[model samples]
Target: MTKLILICCLITALVIRINGHRSSIFAAAPAPSAPAAGDIVADTCKRAAAGDPDLDYNFCKSLLQSAPGSHKADLRGLAVISINLAKNNAQRVLGHIRNLIGEETNNTYRKECLKTCKEVYADAVGELKDSAKSIDSGRIHDARTALSASFDAAGTCEDSFSDGNIPSPLAADDDYYQNIGRIALSLAALLDN
Candidate 1:
């Protein structure tokens, strides 16, 4: 009878020890504190707008605000939105170039310049489109390549006139495209995290 009691007590102690160890092993680790929703948007914009005199916090905020679900966009979403905005800008400028070409029908020199600008702008549009796609699919390297190409295209368009000692009528447009491309590129780099 004492042997039976001893065996039962041993079994109970073993069971208790096993359960305690198992509970300790399965215990959840404390989670890292998450940033507030409001802080996320502000921090994202502030980081984007930082270090560029031309880009202020308000500009970044407004840019993000123009996107759908801007309030809820995380860092990746912000990068996506920036790429989409750059694509939209490229498309708009392409149309503008076409209109400018049509308007320059009577001036041969202006017509030629506009034609060259049109070709480069088309290239820019393609790059922007590709970049947007790559970014949407989370391919940062491909997106960066496209953005680099876009920046080059804009620079090429602007330089084409300078090479010929002629003033570029599309300087403002080229600058705008380059600026947007640069901002998109910056956002793309941030996606590595």
Candidate 2:
């Protein structure tokens, strides 16, 4: 009878141990799941557009969706794409500004505005390089700061024309740069959440 009780006790202890372990398994924290691959871009763009009135939802979605490899991107990938787009646009605008400066031999006011814009855009290009680095290094705050600076650079360029009472030839380019910058900033915000 004593042996029978010992065996029962052993079984009971074993069962208790198994139960404890099972409870712990249930209590443990869950691994974070990524958003569905297909929805990331549109979902991110939707939230971004909702957050910033200056950002258009369709434009953000379309731009990200159309970029190479964006369809399979996570939030970070989308951010990189947005930053790259901004950099490309800014560089193009810078080149266009240089060409304008060269072409305007007589219009000193426009040329002067173009020169200021060139300086601003050049600074923006550098800022964007820093932003890209920040994002790649997992420094979201620094990335946002640099992205915001790059976006502000677009406004500075526009203001260059406005302050001088000269129409901006790069208005469209500035708009594109700012919008993409906003998207990049929004995506960086998502990485922190």
Candidate 3:
């Protein structure tokens, strides 16, 4: 009788543990629905204008679904998208540099940066396809380098931006500065390896 009771208790405990683990896994999973269109659009627009390739490409796609006859908004969206895409592609060269640093074989951070770079690059290139010759490659390169540096700089960059210590027009270009700040932060994170 005692053996039977012990067996049942063990099984019950095992079942409860399994159920708890399952619930925690499910809780961690993200919902299937896409992000809200408005939030995506606003965030993308703001980021792009400010020169943030990561956020710019992320939100840019949703802006395409904006209501018809909103040509002004569309044009603004196109401009931001184009600029960010250019910056994204330019950053790829930096990714290669990052990969070659030390013996870190994981490359997860490099992958994340490149993923963002590709998305923004694709969007910008697509939008500017008609007037590709007008785009300034040098400016794009500068923006990308700045972004990479910003990531390496991390908290200092964030503090500068938050405290308005950086120049006004430059500060207004948050995307550009933020990306550079992020690159500095990423580099800092990589230092642990």
Candidate 4:
């Protein structure tokens, strides 16, 4: 009878141990799951731009949806795409500014604004290139620096008109470049984490 009791107790202890192990397995933290490809851009953009009042979620979603590879890209891929967009935007703005300079009238304020825009947009294009290279090399600090500089360049271009008390003809273009810079910065921040 004593042997029978000992066996029962041993079986009980074993069952308790097994149950504890099973419980732990279920209770432990789950591994981080990657978002689905179609959702990755929106998810990452939402998280990255959470604190930025200037970043509209729906605008970001639409932009990402229209970007190449964005439909099926992961976070890293999104970062690359964002940088490319910044580069393209800077180049496009630079061309627009040059055209404005060529067609600028005798108005001193307009001429000054065009000249400032041209210089800043040129600087922005170069900075964006640096940002892309820095990101590619995994140099987060350098990339952030270049991205921030690009953002500043766009702001400076817009501010030239504001500071001079003149209305900016390139307001829409400036806004577009600024938004692109913000997107790039947000993506860079995501990669930093």
Candidate 5:
């Protein structure tokens, strides 16, 4: 009888210890404290840059902090800002693509690649617009989907040139836009978490 009681007590103690450790392991997230002005951008950019290999921490911080109300923006606002940054970059690249196409009247193949790049940037701009609207409407999944579609433009544009064994006229632009896309996507991911 004493042995039985000892065994039960041991089992109870083990179960209690396991449950206590488990609860500690699964503790709720810490509360968000109010940070000083600009900390939100700094903090979110740091986290986003840490998570994304292509995202430059300095670039991310500068881009986010430059927004009109960045010091006051929450994660969702940062998402919006990042999307806007990418969209603006796409638009600028479109103009650069047009200029390159105009300058390359003889290289039909390079011109073709430029045209494809232009199409992709145009599509990306529209997709980014939809992404912003989706975000505004609280459709996070759709926003991410459209944002991803937009993000593909940079790589797709670069790949078109690579397939033809030609140098990409927009190589630098592609790299720039790719980093912007990574930043935007990373910030959006934070909103989900």
Candidate 6:
């Protein structure tokens, strides 16, 4: 009976030790504190308006990294940031088109179409930036107007691309242009508070 008790005690001790080690391995690390929703929104908007694509992308990426689960607000933030980046990049591309038009020799309808696309892209970027500024300035109606302009430009670009003879990088992907339009619409809706 003494030997049986000793064996049972040894087994219990071993089991306890194993459990402790397992727990140490599987223990959840402390979660970083979430950023305030307002701060996230403000920083994102500020970066977008300031024409810092990298900063804008990082701000959105941080929001997504902090909340990888089913956070609708975070997802919306991600979508908005992405749209802002795209708009900004597209504007930069427009600048390049203007430069090309001045310097390049192959100025044709295709080149003109490309330039027009860039103009539309710049308009969208400006609208989004204005919307962000309006939000920062607490001008809700102005923000809505800016967002409407952004959507209109995006739609015009989509329709132009759909004509199917525009020799631009934008014409390569029908889905991508459609997606940009959708993002513009989504951002406008999300920002409409």
- Which candidate's TM-score is highest? 5
Off by over 4 Å in 5: 1-34
What are the per-residue Cα lDDT tens digits for candidate 3 across 1-193?
A: 9999999778766776877653443355765786544554454345443553444443344433343332433333334344344344335433432443333357555444334443443433343332222223323333444344323322332344345433322222334534433432222222222
Estimate the TM-score for candidate 2: 0.78
* Model 2 superposed RMSD (Cα): 8.9
Q: What are the per-residue Cα lDDT tens digits for candidate 6 across 2-29? A: 9999997787668768776434333467
Top candidate on lDDT is: 5
TM-score of each: 0.72, 0.78, 0.21, 0.77, 0.80, 0.46
Q: List pairs with backbone clashes in candidate 1.
A: none
| Residue pair clashes in candidate 5 | none
The candidate with the higher TM-score, 3 or 4, is 4
By lDDT, the candidates rank as 5, 2, 4, 1, 6, 3
What lDDT would each prediction earn against the true structure?
Answer: 0.75, 0.84, 0.40, 0.79, 0.88, 0.54
Q: lDDT per residue, candidate 4, 9-51, as tens digits?
A: 7876677687765343344576679665568777877987795
lDDT of 4: 0.79
List candidate 6 segments past 4 Å from native: 1-83, 95-107, 158-167, 172-181, 191-193
TM-score of 6: 0.46
lDDT per residue for candidate 1 within 119-192, as digits (tens), equals 87788778878887887888999988988887786677777778778888778878877777666777787775
TM-score of structure candidate 3? 0.21
Position 139, candidate 5: lDDT? 86
Q: Which ten contiguous residues of candidate 2 have the minimum total lDDT? A: 21-30
Angstrom error at residue 33, model 1: 14
Off by over 4 Å in 2: 1-38
RMSD of 3: 20.6
